[model samples]
Target chain A: MSDNVVPMKRTGEATPSLSPILSLTATAMNSVNQVILDRMQSEIPLIPALAGHLISGGGKRMRPMLTLAGAQVVGYQGTRHHKLAAAVEFIHTATLLHDDVVDGSETRRGKSAANIVFGNPATVLVGDFLFSRAFELMVEDGSLKVLKILSSASAVIAQGEVDQLTAQRRIETSEERYLDIVGAKTAALFAAASRIAAVVAEREDAAERALDDYGRNLGIAFQLVDDAIDYDTGTADMGKDRGDDFREGKMTLPVILAYARGDEEERRFWQDAIAGFRIDDADFAHAVALIRRHDCISATRERARHFAQRACDALSIFPDGAARRAMVEAAQFAVSRGY
Target chain B: MSDNVVPMKRTGEATPSLSPILSLTATAMNSVNQVILDRMQSEIPLIPALAGHLISGGGKRMRPMLTLAGAQVVGYQGTRHHKLAAAVEFIHTATLLHDDVVDGSETRRGKSAANIVFGNPATVLVGDFLFSRAFELMVEDGSLKVLKILSSASAVIAQGEVDQLTAQRRIETSEERYLDIVGAKTAALFAAASRIAAVVAEREDAAERALDDYGRNLGIAFQLVDDAIDYDTGTADMGKDRGDDFREGKMTLPVILAYARGDEEERRFWQDAIAGFRIDDADFAHAVALIRRHDCISATRERARHFAQRACDALSIFPDGAARRAMVEAAQFAVSRGY
Candidate 1:
């Protein structure tokens, strides 16, 4: 329990960094970056202007990096993965743009949200452009199987989003329902990003299945940690306002768990806060206190750790190499973020 | 000119109808309809609920009919075109959903808009899901050429929408710019829908180009008539509020021509009405009177006639048959709609 609770250092002394996979995929990832730049260009000034504002605004490219690493681990040598990885990143960025519009979020990735800067209309339209651009990349890659996987993932993600929206401010949202939403909205894309590498590598079904498992578990773990971090008051590095889920009345894991474990008074408080949608700083503080008192934050983190372990175990089928080790570390890093 | 200006009977006597094409493609179109229903279903109840609210709510199925007619004209005997047609319809429906959000439109096809009924967030997310579903259908079709044409068209459509947004309320929007916007926003999908049929039939490049041209010209004609009808006020059609473009300050061809033809005082009226966004029924009546006085409605309809003629010319390459005649009539119907 103690080992799982200690935040793993991501980029410091006495820590195994993700440099192994990052370096291994450096050349290809650069090409992917260039493709992203090239494709985001359009003759319409507003199209490029609004798209560039979001695309170049410090996205971290975690999903594309996973794609490159997946390709590397599968011993794929072709350049097509670069385009697919770019497509993956474009889809993720498009989702972020839409999410901000949906959430009416003012800030993202430590900057004012694109919708705030360019207005909601431009943000929504440019997000559509980027999404269309992603499909164009997939078409250019000329792999129907890859297109099928990613497209299905996209549909699932949208369904998950609607599911989340329907569950908003509902204190009775079950753990099963929460996991279903997370799996559809987030894990599906992660799984597709890694599984695409196997499709590119022309690997056997077993390999594709293994990578899919790795990504699915890692995605669940990553989302669990994100949900938990919204309640943690540590680093303020969630790229959003702290306790946004609370303010938004989002039915995240922490809230669900806290409600489940709380006494009648606490239950009433949650019901009033969520259903009535009233949560100022003081209410948020009380909510945080309740979360901490029930140890739901750590409990949520423990769930993430459990999924992360499964993610690491799924990588065992691959040969021992820097890429494999880096993927395992990446899964751990997903849950280990404190900042 | 008289033949082109007179309204073609769509579901009445005294003129040819689209029933030729619709009946010819009934089997395939039914399959396409089924595909739309099947794909819209999801475990998440809200997604299907919202998507169905829009999709099942009386869309004319015109675009998918074009795809089917295109296939029929090309002598296609395979079933893949059904899926492709469904995909094409999904893309169109998805765009409508998003466009309503962008336009803040309150009604569509004479019903309360999906965004109003389901809320903007649900509308945007479900639009995204349908778009993804379209891509999945394209992938299932397993034709890279088809995928390329449709994906590129999707990107261009998004760009066209942004272009239209940027040009909104600007009286100085050039005819060339307006045409570009119309071509990108509407004709591109029509062109792709027909061109894909040629691809499915493995037809000659000449046939493909002919179908593409036919669809493009028809789309241009369709949009031109739509723009012209905004000022007509004779029919209770248009699926949206009368003078919607005027109230929204949309730079349609009628407004462009009216602005160009107006005198100094009238120009000031036009500029203030557009730029100031001050529109009431009296103002709308004045604007309509100005348009009628300037002959812009007939002028706009004349432009539509020219495109309809071009659309008919493009179909001459096809051997005359039910499909060919229906397509030619469809082009005429595009511009000849009275309501």
Candidate 2:
């Protein structure tokens, strides 16, 4: 995973280099992350106790950075931006805890998952705690619009999770349905975070929509990349066991698309592997090879790039500032990062 | 268990002449229950498919009735009362679904539990959907105060559940801690329902306090009775298996208090049954005998009655109206009903 951290630029882009933007983003994110950690430690003491092991176990804090960067790009100067950033992190943490429980994941980021450490009941209830605490923090912002956006997003995300659970291992699941699930479960929060920042900054409607669009597109790109990496990357690169999604019968985008295009033998393998849950190592390897042979990985990666480009397009409406430049760079970084 | 139904007076006073009040309360509850079924059916089109299964699966709907009675007693004439009542029911239903999943409960209300039918993931996520839908209904009321109350209660209830999970099976759990958990997890919503009714009715401060106290005390009594029934009732009587609390390692008030007063043998029985998870039918019977011999069942019953009396006390501050009389009767019913 560490070996995949490339510099934040494409090799052939003729756009002027923006090193200062990256530096500003890093500085802003550092302060925002600190605020988030401190608030999480104080407000949800149990979270720090439970998540401390995992926090140190390592995560990129990418969501917090997105929020902070989004706020900064729109010229947000108030300290409330810090609170919003922390709220974003809390929401993300809550979802991760619940997701691991739902997935029955034993390891996350190469460390024992929360459910593995504290048990599923503790992991689930604590996840509820973080979600509630996130709402309390959002309420403190005193923006009804922000509250509405966040509350609605949370509802959508939860529904999306249920939709995925219902669709798991179902041979009838389509790529469009898979994308819809991803959009609600993963992208809604990202979009809410970015849009809330713009709302807090009191940006014009167009700017708010642009930032929201940027976040929505970036979130889709990020999730697609994640799904694609599950097939292309090894366990060492992904920091967890590879092919667990297929083993668990989850119909991710690549799997759904590949199954749609497979030959009779390949299709039978896919059905037995996912639908029948006959996911031996050889079958996992076969599914991976089948996805690659079907050009699903490259196709999915291209789809991610398309969304990344759309994310960049949303920023065109923004003034040329350090934050705007960083936003553009971050979208590209999202696509370029290895699984 | 049916034979043991304590035939205490329907009113806390030494009078059996409160039959009118009981009948009025019953009629009001019947109407409210119908409204609840209608609204739940209207909103969930899948109700026809699932309602018979869920409704026949038997729940007391105590929380929803509390909401309706609370609103009626506060003189709220608006149609929003029904929505609030349904909101309470939805929240309660959500909790029950999640509770069954967390406890791995196979039976509820003398039938197969939802998780036993739909699987754990579905139960958990559907529970989440109910909660989200509850919030959506609350938002439609357009009362930020109600939203705030319900939201805070939701958070506190979830936190209480987490606290219970962390403290489960710990022999060191105290009665005070147990009370805290029951108050937050069970009574908080009850209090919120009544308090929100007052807020909606724009009542006087004294009236609001009276209703809030009534609801809180009623909730405490309700939970106390529930805990006691775990020892005194069987599956056929209680609609679910007895000794479930013990099996789940939950440290209810009676158990905590009993453990404090237990002899060495009894203490060992509890330790093995709960903390060590070595419970058997023999252990359950032994535990029941110990509880009876120690008079813990009677002691717990007295405490429940005390809370019921306190609930009636809150109503003395209200006017001599039918609603107030019904509220008083309901409290008595909660404590003295089929044991």
Candidate 3:
């Protein structure tokens, strides 16, 4: 995890937190935070209540950070990215709300999921509210190109969610399908968030695409590490419960890879657990043991490292600076988890 | 119910069907239908399966018809309105899917609600998909103004829905609050749908405002009649079950009006019925009798008539023609349900 060990160019001391990027974009992030609060405000008390619960909830604001940093990296001096950052956060939060309902999870970020507290109907409707608010922000920005990028991402995200729903509990889900889900459900927004910064900078297609590639690869790596963590995360300070993904029978990359490479009897065991026929503590222990024995978590992290490397490489197009270095460290930070 | 009986200027025979305007915008309506079918298409089988269930389900396409008629009335010749009209329908359908989930509706238009057929999660996500697709349509139309109108309507609709949720089974809900809920939940979209026609036609501010007013009033009138019909809809050809609002404890106009004017004993009956404390077949019959005795249904229709008159008056700014006449009759037709 040392800066020397990381393959990315060493521009400064490796900050373990996102604070470097956050401090660099502190003023703009503050504006983005204000915009998030202002937009979720409504005469309907339920909206602000529920949206505030999630917005002020323990979200790292990573998506918006990527946006602000994306804008800053390209030296864009404008206020529009603030609104766009808030929009990105709203989209991400909306997906989380919907995902909680779909996942039927009781907790999020170590607290009660919004759906559990507010009820499924309110969570779903408030998610809709956040989504509409996102579009309103884009429309207020008055950029058709921005609107097109974000709206398409929104659609792709929904499609990815549906695809994941279909793939749930199906042991035959291929690596390609799993990647497609991650790309659309997670990375699509990341790509859009970063690409939008370039759009605001009015940068050329190459820069826009580069930032998009950076965000997309980072998103993939982040999700891979998350999936790996669900099995055995040493970084338990984040408060995410282990084995929730296994209980939910989510086809994360580690499970998919393990199930694909396992012996016939191991495959049967996975199928039974995934099909919810006989899931128990022993089953979880067995699954974790299998994943560890096969080095599935490490393999997943290895894949994540590859993508993280790609994410750092994508930033080579941008000039070296504090912003670019923080972004590169952010990529390294994603894959360095659970080491 | 004839043209002569209506207060609006008579220019043509009153047709109970929406065919007059539908035929006038036949080509545009066709394109809208294509877009609707096209946008709902996805690689995920459940999306199209569930969306097709609701899309091809027995919806009358009334909202999209309004958009088409509104465009034709404004003498718009472009195809953007077609896309806009499709967007309007998508919004309407998206709300229906969510509404079915929220209301726990078993049936829509004499068919099982999408939530019942496809489960709530898929229905909710597909609804999100349709909403995002609607925004994509507006973005493709490249009109920030259009996006503004539609996104605002979407926000209002969600807020209105939340307002209605708060008011559910609460007899203390005032007529003003009920109207507010209706305005946000239904009329706002109508306003946006009609106003967008003027926007696309590049009409003056006066025309845009006029069309917006017309659609808003018509939407209110339409909802009022529908609420009244929930008590006793003589026009039962549409196959909607009577007393659904009553069974669900929905505080529709008739229920609110009757509850406001009822005697002390009757008030208790209504409070208990609406609170689901004593809802049964006998309660429905008594509720119907009470509504009839208090003239609440007629009073509701009378209120609808006033809004219908306003809707017609809003059209006076435009020139008279078959389209205009059809639009005028459409308003009267909204209030002439029981005849």
List RMSD in Å for every model shown: 3.6, 5.7, 2.9
User: What does candidate 3's lDDT look like per residue over B63-163, in tens digits?
Assistant: 88888888888898888888888999999999999998888889898888899988888988999999999999988898899999999999999999988
Q: Estimate, for each residue in A1-339, the C-alpha lDDT of model 2 and write its tens digit.
A: 232232335578754333544576676777766766665452325556776656666777667677777888888887676776777777778778878878899999988899898877767666666666676676666566776777777777777887787788887888898889889888898788888888888888987898889899989988998888888754347585778788889888888889888888888888888785678888888888899889998888888888888888787777776677677777776676663
lDDT of 1 by residue, A127-232 (tens): 9999999999998888899999999999999999999999998899999999999999999999999899999999999889988998899899999988998889
lDDT, candidate 1, equals 0.87
Query: Which regions of candidate 3 deviate over 4 angstroms?
Result: A1-6, A9-16, A233-237, B1-6, B9-16, B233-237
What candidate 1 gets wrong by more than 4 Å, as runs, is A1-17, B1-13
Q: Report candidate 2's fraction of native contacts.
A: 0.35
Model 3, position B157: C-alpha lDDT score: 95
- Superior candidate under TM-score, 2 versus 3: 3
Give the CA lDDT, 0 to 100, for residue B101 in model 2: 73
lDDT of 1 at A111: 86
Model 2: lDDT to the true structure: 0.74
Docking class of 2: acceptable
Compute the lDDT of residue A263 as modeled in candidate 3. Answer: 95
